[model samples]
Target: MQIIVRAYEQSCAGVLVDEVTVEADVSKTGQQSTFSVALNTPDEDGDGYVAILGNGKGGTDCNDNKNQRGALMSPGNLEVCDTIDNNCNQQIDEGLDKKWYLDEDGDGVPRGPDFISRCSKPEGNYMEYPDGQQFDCRDTGADAAKMFPGNSEVCDGIDNDCNAVVDDGFPTLGETCNAECGGVRVCAADGLSVVCSQEPGRYYHPDRDGDGQGASGSLPTLKCGTEPADPGTVSNDDDCDDADPATCEGLAEVCDAIDNNCDGVVDNATPACGGTLKNVASHYVNLGGDDWKTVSVAANGSVWVAGHDGKLALRRPGAQKFESFSHYNSAPQAPTDGSPVLNNNNCGDHDWNVSWVNANGVVFLGGQTGWIGIHTGAANFTCVPGQMPTSQDAITGMIGFETGGVTTIYVGDTSGRLTRWRPSAPFAEQFTVVNNSDFAYYGLHALSPDFVLAVGNSVTGSVQKFVSYDIDSQNPVTPPTEHVANPNNISGNVRSVWMGSATSACAVGDNAAVWRWDGGTGWSKVVGPTGVTGRFSGVVMRNDTQTQLIGQCYIVGGDGTSRAKVHRLTPYGWAKPLDIQSATANVALNDLAITPTGEIWIAGEDGRVFHYPEP
Candidate 1:
């Protein structure tokens, strides 16, 4: 229920001096009510308002609940800016004479209205209408030497300009700094500034043999300066001996039975011991046409190159130049004279497109016409008889391995079919292992004689997803197991795969997508280099656990600008771009291989070749 209370007062002259009416709802306890409007009354117990009892003067009850002697209050009675509702208008220090001190030292700035409110400036350091020039943020009291704006900055370990930057003109004590010497810089123990000193985190090992290089293998030091010592040092542990500067990393592999280049291989430069790759020269072979597709280098120094128009070139051991051959003339045509012309299935002349060379000097070259030619010698190549089923033709990838004294070659086609061929005298057809309609195999790499990895795109998904298949020797006749790999949370077709071992492999493809295969984790994508998102057609990884060059992976392909790009992966991430040419030439590196003797060779379109380590 609602309740109303009215209060009235009259003056001695018989006039209505004060009148107030309040309305409220009765509380559930029946002892109090909540007032809707309270006028000029102070709630003492806060148990809802009682009434507005005036002093018999017009609006004289500034605080109705207070004693009658305390009700005489007005705005004109306040004399200073003290924190109090002196006029009973619920406002403190309203319309009072005051002065804003020039609080330069911030010591005189009042925290609240409880300050000395004077009409004129104070006698002691305080002024009126203050600005930043008069305010000192750091000032504490009068005894403290006054620091204010417009003061000249000097390196006396104080903010002279009031800018808050202390002693920024020189390096402060205990700060990490750099010096001209190869060693790192540390704040001196006794001095006021930093000095050149050694820190365990960063130490430099200098080359004393004057070889323009530094010895590695010493505990690494994080020196900030780029200047080298008297005989400089490099930032790696590849040096076999720091005392002998001539025995540093990347040295020439001479025939002195020593493991030069610190690769743990002795006398490996010659082709007899495996082959030594050279970056000193670029040999371009012209086939009177364009389009060079792929190249493969065997362990024994046999280089086999293949491309469009059924072109094949071979560079055998001790040969200075590549010998070119044409497969167009050998492809079987329609039997015009009933003499059994090649059933090329309309695949253009001698298009022996992809080539693979095994360790036994055996090469298998295939092309679009379902033709796979076997080459035992360096010069002659023989095409296997019979054509594949029309849907299982158009070879995309081929690899071979020898097991139980027999060499078996596996071929992957565009329709996701894998076929096995036994190169026994007549190259007999073994069996078709898999024919999955959901995925298209683009590349294959043999991890061992027992396992092979097939990589390509999964067409059944909403987006083309990069996937792989593991073909084991025990189940070579059945469909291989499939595994999907996606890099950067997106899917793209994988173009190539290189298996360093059964436990380690790397695959590359569209949008610079890179994935690594591990025996423990299956397959995982690698975060590519920043700012170089482009299609990658080639990748080679070298963990080299036995040598000094461990933990290095190399990737080569085209970038967003269509330029040939080379990136090396350290433990941190992809190193900076190692490219000199721009996109003008379209230098897309299609394939790359690292030789046993520490030589890197990369080739692509326009017959372009790049040798790394730039020796």
Candidate 2:
């Protein structure tokens, strides 16, 4: 409610004429809550607004006391780019803010850092905010035409693509580049890139048989290109026989007369032999094969059994029976029973003793009556001409050529004569007597390419001795001198010898007298088994993986009871008889062979060939 108090003039009738009024708002509840009041007044300035007495200024004008401007700043006034509230209430140039740069070159891009905020794009390549963010470093220099990021780079070491790195995408000076076939290219001397050239030669190994093994020689086919188009050819030559695919290094040695394993050695040394004896054979019936004297396994696993009857028998590998060779002293003819045929000329009647040959598997035989022959395949044998003169000079032992391509066959005779024969030349006498006595040399061993040892007994003294000769000497070997001194005048005759190393050699003799030779200590007698009544005919040293167990002297001979006796010499001395076959009259083991597979083979009287373990 509005309450007004008026000043009344005390005049004659209290008519309340021309009175001044004062007013205020009053609450009816008397609780002093919020209240407002206004005095009714007229609109001044014709803007439909006014202020009343008893109240603060209230109007639609910034200055209510004034009448000209209505609101503090009216809407729809033109905005300007000023750092002030020019339109009045509060803000500065908000919506009118525009970033513009000076593109003095007019290339549609602007120069560095020289820009301003404007309402719109100015004339002549000037851009606003987004398009103006691009800053050009040069505006009037030689690079100005290429100032844009899309411009290609020149060799001036300047920024390209507007990125930081200089001369980045261009070829680096002196950097090397390679091609497919060993060709090389480098950044050029003139500071440009060079073409890939000067390719290397292409060498290929021929494998016409597709065996995956290359040829044997060092020769290779050279060309200039990528690999040759032939898949059968490679870059290595190692295959000995490239005409047969099954003759590679990975192929196992089959019972064929070929180097199937490509190991340079023949199939005789293959690893397929079981460790123990197997498939023992005693005799060949109905086949003119009897009393086999010497035996050898050929590259094809064919066992060549030489009989005392002057006939040769061939047992095919893995076969149970043997067949006599068709022709031993006549024209070559195929055997009827699919046996190996032979042709021999002037190989006099003699008992075969030793048989061995060179790495090429050429067969050589030595025997009684000064007889020595060479087997030239297809069942053909030719007596080596100009052999020792008399039957008393029978070749007892034979060893193949050693060192160099010398091809010297060292032979020993029962008369103690030592001879050296080159397969290409006639026999040359080496020594007529060894150890200052005529000892019947029974066995020969090559300790090294230059060193050879001959073992036998001197009939004059009835004692055994070994003679060493250096066949490689410039001068004739200082006439075979005694290497071992018989301290006790050992009465046994050494029958066989084998060398494990240049300085490590072992010799076995009558009554199992084992003698060891060390370069530093010379030869000393080591006591062997006392049970051996007969002389050891053959001995071998096993140096394969079983060296810990088998690296000893394996001596084969017989006891007086006519049973085969095999003994071994261990570190502590000779062990008891390692193997002793049942006693059979006239059954004596004459030789023993150790195969590459660690198997032991024994050949003896009565055409006996026993594989270890009887497998």
Candidate closest to the true structure, highest lDDT:
2
| Best candidate according to TM-score | 1
**Against the hidden reference, what TM-scores do the models get?**
0.50, 0.48
- Name model 2 segments beyond 4 Å from true: 1-279, 282-289, 296-303, 314-323, 326-348, 380-386, 389-392, 426-437, 559-562, 576-586
Q: Model 1 over residues 497-584: C-alpha lDDT tens digits?
A: 7777667777777788777777543567887776767888776665332243334466777546425556665333453344533342
Displacement of the residue 527 alpha carbon in candidate 2, Å: 2.1
**Model 1: residue 7 alpha-carbon error in angstroms:** 99
**Candidate 1: residue 460 Cα off by (Å):** 4.3
lDDT (Cα, tens digit) per residue for candidate 2, span 1-615? 444433222333332222234444453556655544443333343433332223442322222233444322222334466454334345656567477777665555667576776665666677653543557656666656555555565534466446656556566534343433555544334433344454556677778666666777736777566545466687678776654454667777643224567876444543554333333543341232345556665544555556454645555556655545423444433445543334344344557787664555455777777776665434445544334543346676667654576666677887777766556644344322222237788788874546777888886877886888765444433467567554546877878887776777778777767788775335788865654566677887666444343446777774453246556675445533444333332466777766544455566775466555342
